[model samples]
Target: MYLVHTAHWQFLGLTLGFLAWILTMVTAGLNEWRLWHMDDVSVITSGVAWVGIWKVCFYTHVLPQMEFCRRISMSDSFLPVEIPVAQVLMALAVICGLAGSISGGVAMRMVYFTVEDRRNIRLVFILTGTLYLFSGSCSLVPLVWNMNSVLINSTIDFPPEYYLPVVPVRQQVGTAIGVGIFASILMFISGLMFLCYKYARHTLRSVAPRSTSNPLRGPWTTTAQRSNGVNKGSDNPAFLSEEVSC
Candidate 1:
């Protein structure tokens, strides 16, 4: 019965999230290929693929049956129950996950161009890359923690045999917390790299030369003419000797 109440919305949200993830991945991949000349689009592509596959598995194979039991749980209520708060939270997590992944991909590309200092660029890449990884990981928590399952199983209205194997709530909460911590660390590192890059560039520009003399402006001949103060005809033997010697 809980599934009846939550499955449709949950599936809809998941479907939207999956499609967005796919789009972001494709866009990021093509952009990377065109701009960076690096051939490792697979790293981000694989994450999107995994999430999409999992979403399909949940929607087609798992949710329908779960919905049947959920419907039974809500039959007694005359008024449609208000949407579960958990569903709202899950939707937010999915959005954040997608955004983080896209941002991280862009940051990774930035690092490739920022490679004048390997240490600084490496730190930036790690930070932004981890932010995406953690965000995606956090998105899975809501799907896994479907609290509706626990409520339905605990109620006597649902038969014991019909109880579904819900993911433990503790596990879901733990995963979300872990990802949050990881993302925070990544953010800190990214901020540090940005500051360092700004400072380094500023220092370099301050001391660099504004202009340089041209080497091919006839320095040798100019010096000779200036010292002699008079021009000798090219036909003269003295001019020929001077030209040959100097």
Candidate 2:
């Protein structure tokens, strides 16, 4: 059999994990995790300035138009605690997701191809699940933290050279954070599915031996002694009626 759960859901889980990894990588590279709006200002420069773990941007699509994105340093004086924390967390998430993906792919191949013993297959599945779960956790912490900060209009003691307002009149979660949230959820679910698959396969395989271990009682056959006894009327002849040809 294809397994008790049929393995379809497990395939979906692996696909979800791969998509989450891609989104996390994109989120790590994006500068839209948080936004600061300058639309209230009465100048052509008025627009949005967004920031990420390692970079910030300032841009206006109209008059005096330009786009500027520059890397920010964790070592900068008086930087918000969130930035440095996000840098480490997002990097860790990317790394973990990558490791999980590689292991997961290899494990899938081994499973469908029957390349190893059952114990080794179980181990690989568990390892992949752990790594993906860790990746989701890493992403969720920083993304949620920054989203809360934006909700509260959190401020920092950024030095004047940084040109960031101590408190922007308007701020919101950005595209990157939204993407991270979705990716985190998908990654989390995928990890859970993989773990379930591992345990279920183990449990089901262990029980299967008990059901058909006796060749005489196998699903597709019966004991020759039983057949002979029935033929000779030593056993219940009525039972053989069921298997008799017309």
Candidate 3:
């Protein structure tokens, strides 16, 4: 008989995480739409929307299957069937999708702020886009691997009474791990870049000099005084006559 080892808590955690990711993606999509309709649309709008679409798809299709697999596995009355690795991979893909969405969203926000530095803006887009792409790829890994597994494992050991379809659990798990790693890496990179940009801009502004006015002079006033050759001491006749009595 198949023994179910359902990690209910872990499943719940993952579910919540996926939901949060979906929320973030939706928020990003709305933000992008708002920007797009505006006269001052940003270049980052498309990028953000791309990230959001991937996230929504992952949550809607992939995450539910993963949850179902996990729940069925933990059920006491269920057969002792192994969970396919494909499902695990799918879960991981969802996580990666989440990370990508977040990274893209943040990058888009940065662009919207009109962060004058072109270099910084480009860097933000490159890093975030890379994360989004990598995670999206990782999300598909389990599905691909599982299909391959099923094709290869045509004749597996199974009792005549055991009637559960063999799903690719291991492949799924591998995919999930891959996605999780990619997501984590991107999160770290984007966060570091954001902090560095903030610090550099702040430091540059802090040490800059302030413009000041001279206490007793304007440009025209100073020029007039110089051309007139008027001396304050000349008002005293005694001081003037001492040097040139003629």
lDDT of 1 by residue, 1-246 (tens): 011222233223333333544433332222111011112233222111111111111112333333121232223332123213323433454465565445444444443344444344435434544444444444334323333333332222213332322221221122223333344334333333322332122233355665455677534332223336776533546888999999
Residue-level lDDT of model 2, residues 143-231, one tens digit each, is: 99999999998876656554666777788899999999999999999898878874334333454444636666566443344464475
lDDT of each: 0.33, 0.79, 0.36
Q: Which is the leading candidate under lDDT?
A: 2
* Model 2 per-residue lDDT at 54: 83
Model 2 residue 237 distance off true place after TM-score fit, in angstroms: 37
| TM-scores for the candidates | 0.31, 0.74, 0.34
Selected candidate, larger lDDT, 1 vs 2? 2
| Ranking of candidates on TM-score, top first | 2, 3, 1
Best by TM-score: 2
TM-score-wise, the better of 2 and 3 is 2
lDDT of 3 by residue, 75-182 (tens): 323322222443344455456656655655555455445445435654654554455445445444533443344345422232323222233122112223333344
